[model samples]
Target: MMLHTALNWRYATKRMNGRRVPDATLERILDAAHLAPSSYGLQPYSIVVVDTPELRERCQPAMYHQPQVVEGSHLLVFATWESIGNAEVDQLMALIAEERGVEPASLESYRHTIAETVARLSTPEARHQWAARQAYLAMGMVLTAAAMERVDATPMEGFDPAALDEVLGLPERGLRSAVVVTLGYRDLETDWLAGLKKVRWPRDRVIVRAE
Candidate 1:
């Protein structure tokens, strides 16, 4: 059943009909992103859901005028935290301590370790890069979950990150756009890519044995 479920899913979406995806389905996709694993449990990113037609129209230019930006039912903009500062680390450590019922004082050693690690990457650009990697993990999880829910999705990296950040006002929140995924039902009639075969390296060629 698991194999069948996965095999039935493919990234063949190019154009999406204007039909809207149900809110519940979208919620499930977002929930999957929330549950995705991240380094140090920092969760250094947030998912921005763009469902309104007006907003999508505005975002189209940022996405290289891609039709899917406005045609899809929803556009999920993955934004990464701008910087990893002491405040952020402290908050995460505090939450971990509280959630695990460990003494806050016991986590002082961990706090110092994490603080020093973040301190080493002092520039905003470096921190953003780290956060972007975490966002990609969430993006992958969202795509897989969409497939499981029988929804079509397109993982796009062709957008102008700076423009998207400006349009979405992410920079104001100390976040930067890392990636975008369009979600909806695929338009089989107009999408040529839908009919093309998916190409990938064979498992034998891609996977290497440790021995």
Candidate 2:
């Protein structure tokens, strides 16, 4: 019920106070995102933490000059790998073996399964789309974690991706921005949304249970 309350209290904060989120609290939120599940447990996304004002200032134009982009304490850019093939599968298998204390050879069949899925994509675009979906799973975790921590978070997809990619040097890193979220404390005095009620589709209309 604590999570329920947190979700109810949180909103897509439009204005921020520029108060920095504590490092420990930020880490806990990031840790939750890291632990989010992905296909075959092969997480294909990376989070770029942008906490410096200068950097956020540079990112402002890319985000269409959203005030929160600069006023927020930090930005979390979730990016998907530009490629995911056999090599990525191999790395996942190796990490799994190391973490579970098993032989890499024992994971051969599982590795093949992951590789086969990647091979089935047939095109770079398809692979990128698949990876982007994985990135959004992590995004959900990030929003929930921020809510639980009582940190204002605003997930955004209003940016020019190509411009943002260039600004952040994402192509060189083999990543492309999938989504961005800004974190900070909401400004109660001036934010119009602060006093409004949270609106959503009623549960009965949104949820459908089928036999």
Candidate 3:
């Protein structure tokens, strides 16, 4: 019920009042993104939290003049890895081993699964598309987390990925911008959609009953 209320209270906020989301709240929201599930436990994405005024200014034009890019306290650029390779999988496995206090080789099954992912996503196009889907999952988690924290967030896809990568210097890190989520407080009076009802298809229509 609380989640429902939170979801109902939220929207793709069109205008933010440029108020900063509290640091603690921002941490929780980001943790939710980190904890979001990903394919093959790779979690092959990076979130660039843009809090600097200069960077936000640079980002606005990249987002095609979207006000949220500049108005929000923080802009999360969900960029996924250009490609997942054996080296990447090995890094993740090593981290997992360190966290669990076990040898990386002990997780053979998991390694195999990730190896399969590397093989399947051999092509650049395949890897980019797969990485983007994982990036979307991260964004969805951030949206729900922000709603629960009573912070405003706007998930945006209408942006020049190439331009964003350039602005953020992501290409050098072997990442490409997949999507963005701007975090801030909504402008109560100015946001036109703030007063509108949340519209969606009926639950019965969307939810299939297999049984």
| Top-scoring candidate (lDDT) | 2
Q: Which 10 successive residues of model 3 have the least lDDT summed?
A: 116-125
Clashing pairs in model 3, backbone N/Cα/C closer than 3 A: none
- TM-scores of all candidate predictions against the true structure: 0.94, 0.97, 0.95
54 Cα displacement, candidate 2 (Å): 0.1
| Model 1 worst lDDT window (10 residues) | 3-12
Cα lDDT of model 3 by residue, 18-67, tens digit:
89999999999999999999987788889989998799999888899988
Please list the C-alpha lDDT of all candidates, in the order they appear: 0.88, 0.91, 0.90
**What is the C-alpha local distance difference test score of candidate 1?**
0.88
**What is the C-alpha local distance difference test score of candidate 3?**
0.90
Give the winner by lDDT: 1 or 2. 2
- Model 1 Cα RMSD, 1 decimal: 1.5
Worst 10 residues of 2 by lDDT: 122-131
- Candidate 1 lDDT at 15 equals 93
Give the winner by TM-score: 2 or 3: 2
Backbone clash tally (model 2): 0
By lDDT, rank the candidates, best first.
2, 3, 1
Q: How are the candidates ranked when ordered by TM-score, highest leading?
A: 2, 3, 1
Alpha-carbon runs more than 4 Å astray in model 2: none
